[model samples]
Target: MNTRDWNETLRSLNVGLPDDVERLKAAGYYEEAIARIDAYLAEDWTKTQNSPYSQGLCPHMDVQPENPTPHGVDVLRDAMIAQREIMRRIPAEYTWSKADAIAEMQRRVKDFTPEEFEMLDRENRMDWRFVEGEKRYQNRFASTLIATHADLARRQIDPPAQPDSEKERCRRLHEKMAEQGSASARITLKASVGMSDEAFAAALAKAKAEGRDAVHVRAWLPLPAACLSQSDIELEEFTEEPTVIAPENAPQRTVCWEADLTENRSFGVQYSYRNTAVYTDPFDTPSAPEQPDFDTEEQPSHIVFTPYIKALAAQLTAGITDPMEKAKRIYDYVTLNVRYHYQPSYFIHESLPEHCARDRRGDCGIMSVTFITLCRAAGIPARWQSGLYVTPDEVGCHDWAMFYVAPKGWLYADCSFGASMARRGDETLRQHYFGNLDPDRMVANSVFAAPFTPPMLGFRADPCDNQTGEVEADGVGLYGDETVSSKELVQYIEE
Candidate 1:
């Protein structure tokens, strides 16, 4: 299946599980739910006419081409994903039982009591869910609770110490940029140029299926792309020659390779890029008479302007007409309101922005998407940009937003960083993120939910963003559980 068709099919399918399947799974009858899904698909497979399941046939199931019923296939796929989610992701993430949570909390908090745990649970500060009629707490619940609850954070026996060296570096960088001039005098200032070299590796774990020793494996790993703040990208080295390297301008850029695997084989690449920090104060610049409509419309499946989104946007931007102010309002709403929490995977989410807004919990990408959606709904042009937060100390996937104001053009918004600053009680730096970004970024993608140049025939592990990497074996996609990836900072030089 081509990229466009796959995306359309994903958008067309309903997000929620089938009623009977959901009921069975909720009741802990997982096997029964799987059986029911298989039965439904088998029935649909035999249908010759007058079947709703056969109406929209997608020939990309990665299964038998003769059985190309997307409705049933998608239902089965969703069911399997749910099964993996509950059995693998949820269990692995939420590893604490009631007793375990209590023990861990008491160890961390000198005078911790069961009553405090109950209170935290009541306040919904501890992330937990019922699994098989028993409550399971998230593995990071204690740390998260302490981080978010100020009083708890103060009372801890040994409070977790956060590293501030990076923050100070960013503050100094912003200060240097701010010294240039006011936004009215200089609409955009790019300073603190830095060059970085990084190496990344990805490999598929040996498949568990019988007699699959020689499976044909394919992989796609991200590579830096040129953007306003990022440039001078060079693919320096590779462990093995890649089959294809995406165009420099591809929105979701990647280097692709294929190999027949007799044993576990790692594919690696080394790349260098130069990133420049950007700063702009929208408050200092007057709004243009006419702002461009680019990126002001909805992007479906994630950035759609549903009724709830429209209502929320209207409420947030009520009586506010300035485009830059509207964007700032949206950014402030997300950063101040939403709590950061680790997510399972983007493929599992039906609408990321709506999920973040409704749940009030999301990671960096979710917050960015929510901010982008609200900005667009408020008649402001906003878009997605993400890759890695490549610092000398560490390398990890990160995402942020960009909004276009007429005179200032595209200003950056790192809602996650702003929220972090809020948690740390640093209003100065929190506000800085609304219109500025540091030089410690490697941008590989400028568009959200974009397809690859040579698209994968099977489903992608993350359909929304390609951060780490993706792999497929013998035409079947592999989830994160079936793969391992690593990113290493090779070198960094301040210019």
Candidate 2:
């Protein structure tokens, strides 16, 4: 079959490699087929070998520009050889198992042409309404599951207890949820003014599935007196409002760290030949190699990031108490507890909880991801936001979390950096991180693993789950040293 036919077959089967490669091999173009495969493999080598942090003129190492790093080139070469071997072995035979296809197709997409990948992204992003709705859908999806899981985990730790009063019982449930790490969890009361039956169903289904560990009602939003009277569902009477915020009506903000030049001055103006390595963007995936389409029903991961910003949501209620106190509780836990590491250099389908279990440390993305996971686990709605940190002289990449805390709206939290500052004994960085943020940054985009509303014509160059930028035909910009300006942030900015 011709290339077109082969491509059609592969497309129909949802595989990444072209059918021509297989046919060519069977057609006895042994040398020619190997050569073709080698060419395809070459692309993989080029894309996969580069770290998001590689610096200097020739970011990919294929062509050296005026400024080149010896260390960077060495890494590029090593990755090139490694990926070349991986590409060489992709069987030309098209055995289309969904499980196998999902795995292998992801590989092919990663290796596919950047333009083609962009096109796929564009196709997915054509509908704006879908994209916005996905944000809301994502919010509900996270709240339901996280609440369920937290409740499950809580019940696993503490069974329901009989108390002297209904209020006591409610207090016991709240305490139980917190002990099991569901401190941020919330419950929907049927007496709420604007709550819908659909939301109630979703919450109920989730709680039942999780065995009802962390459940509560907004003080102003009273429990359906009828439902409470009928069922053994413990009732709690509160004279004062709960201090926590709910996810639905929270304010969201982005905090940028302004890079100053004083600290970035060259020490003795030194230059040395150092070897470096180029790694792909951690979120890069072959299947969705193009930019993401936020509007598409085809979410990148079935395992979505859930945000539990219930503390923020508490303020939205009419008769709520102590909003700031609740917010402080959340800010403290995330900023103090979660550790940040630079490992897990790539993104996968596993949720942040899974990542936390495996790698104790992660960079900003994973930290923000975990924040979302925890917030959702607590019944608070949260979402992702990432972009470049623009200072006077340099642009560095950053990621942080935003949660819906009703009265205050969607508030921004940068816990990863907050944790870092605390470790370094920088009280300013730690203090400014929790509720307030530094002013020297800009948000290029927000939302994690979310596709650009209007997809590009082809798939993205690296389309797993991340924010990306391109400086050259083949170079993929990543976090750390690979940043466009790198540490130069200190050189350009005055303040």
Number of the predicted model whose TM-score against the real structure is largest = 1
Q: Determine the C-alpha RMSD for candidate 1 after optimal superposition of all C-alphas.
A: 7.6
Q: What TM-score goes with each of the models?
A: 0.81, 0.34
What residue pairs are clashing in model 1? Answer: none
Candidate 1 Cα outliers beyond 4 Å, as residue runs: 1-9, 13-17, 22-31, 45-95, 107-109, 150-164, 180-213
Task: Compose the digit string of candidate 2's lDDT tens values, residues 240-320.
Answer: 233332121112111111111111111111011111111111112222212222222221232232232233333323252
lDDT of 1: 0.74
